[model samples]
Target: MTDPGRPFPRHLRQALRTIAARVYLAVCAALLVWALVVTTTDSSDDSMAGVIPLLATAPVSLVLLVLPDHAAALVVAVVLGALVNAAVIGWCARALRR
Candidate 1:
């Protein structure tokens, strides 16, 4: 039986699925870029580990500019990215739930 209480329409559901997939792909791509950067750079010490977080933040910052003025974009990006990552983690956890 269909759940009448469900709020999303078919198209909206599809769109969310697409967004989630894209976010997953983007995260994977970002990780790959980070790995490449680390590999190419001199591994003198643990200092190179810091670059991964910076690279991850850059794309999120760019995405934030789409919503508001440039000055507020950094704050918006950080908040939005945190929320998105949290959602992704929750989704994964639910999928793994027994």
Candidate 2:
């Protein structure tokens, strides 16, 4: 069993508190909102409404293409991609802080 001291390491916590990390998170939040709006409002087959979010999300966003076509799946994919991006940003900020 692992020690139950801190749930997260010191550096990671610090990184998450940094300005760059916060900005990234904010941008991700906006993107998520945009994606949700596009997904829910645009029903046309050639809407092209998801392009911005999909491109902004990149590699993780690719999951949307492979998953079964459904609104829930799209939401899940975007949320997952945003989470992964937040983690990456936090790690990068932590590394650069050292």
Candidate 3:
């Protein structure tokens, strides 16, 4: 028989999962913001081309993690950012291909 005063086992598991998800999302947001700031502020000739996708994807991934309820917005952002990045890369590749 279950104890009258004790909570169900699944409740604790669910709560832990929620907390973990929030923490992961917050970390992703912080990383995205940091990378964005760095990329914008620094103007070295060394190509930062690689970091752009990381900047774009981090926020979207955070949204997916923390706000599963808002999956549409998150997914749209991811797709649009990816397409933009791809287009830019394709342009560069074509230019180099010539």
Candidate 4:
């Protein structure tokens, strides 16, 4: 919905948010790929092996990528997502802070 032709504050803000979201999702996907690799490579016969939980995470990453049909639902999802992203990012920043 944002027009790149004009440099407006709202547009820039939205663009930044979109970029941040894509970056976050990409990081998650990368982690999922690593998990997939580990899950396949781990030869443990136990159902409760360390990599078993990785199997569960892949589906969640897939589900979150789905877009809701309704505008209100989309808005709610984005807002909630942004909040969660901010919290996690803040936490990570704190942990990694110098």
Candidate 5:
């Protein structure tokens, strides 16, 4: 059982405990890291590697596109987007199992 005093609700806590949630978050992390490495090492401006990660995280971070282009912005978008996506996807998976 979940503790009532915990910040996360029971459903969310349960969702995060599942394997699906971890996989989703892992994918996001991998993409984000790949994007960063490609951007830093590749001279090509049209590299799809960097863009792909942003696209993957676009569901939640799309709004962040309006923010000025900066390292901080990208980091925030990727991190937060990954987290939100994982939580939602995990929650849905848990719900489906019920």
Candidate 6:
């Protein structure tokens, strides 16, 4: 039988999970912004280093890892991630055609 005084582990686990989810969300947001910057910058420069794809996919991926049951978060992240990736690719392609 679980002891009445043994709530610490459960509380600790939840706290850790919440912190992880927040961190993942923050990172994803940053990556999305970085992808936009990469797209706008000069194509001749190597600042992006071909990481746009990874940035595009990181939102949903990291959110899922942090909050598996958060379907809403997953959907939002996926949609946003897709849009970010699309924007980056579109800009890059346009830069190339110039």
Compose the digit string of candidate 2's lDDT tens values, residues 8-96: 55545665676776786677668778767876787776666566666666679786668898766666677677666766787787777
RMSD of each: 10.4, 3.6, 17.3, 10.7, 3.1, 17.1
lDDT of 1 by residue, 1-98 (tens): 33577654642344335455456546645654564566558466454443343346455645665776542454455446544554555455545553
* Cα error of candidate 3 at position 41, Å: 0.4
Which candidate leads the pack in lDDT? Answer: 5
Q: Which candidate leads in TM-score?
A: 5
Per-candidate Cα lDDT values, in order, are 0.50, 0.69, 0.47, 0.45, 0.78, 0.50
- In the range 19-98, model 5's lDDT, one tens digit per residue, is 98898778888988888898888887876675676777777787776678886788788778877887888879987998
lDDT string for model 4 (14-70, tens) is 433554445664554564456446656768744233232223333442245366654
Global Cα lDDT for candidate 2: 0.69
- Candidate 4: the clashing residue pairs are none
For model 1, the local distance difference test gives 0.50
**What lDDT tens digits, residue by residue, belong to model 6 across residues 1-98?**
43487675653344334433445446656765665566567576556522543444665445544545543544455546654444444445444556
Give the lowest summed-lDDT range of ten residues in model 3: 11-20
Candidate 3 lDDT over 1-98, as tens digits, reads: 43577666643333334433345445445654565566567788564533443455554434444445442544445444443444444445444556
* Candidate 1 local lDDT, residue 75: 43
Q: By summed lDDT, which 10 consecutive residues of candidate 5 come out lowest?
A: 1-10
**Model 4, stretches more than 4 Å misplaced?**
1-17, 45-98
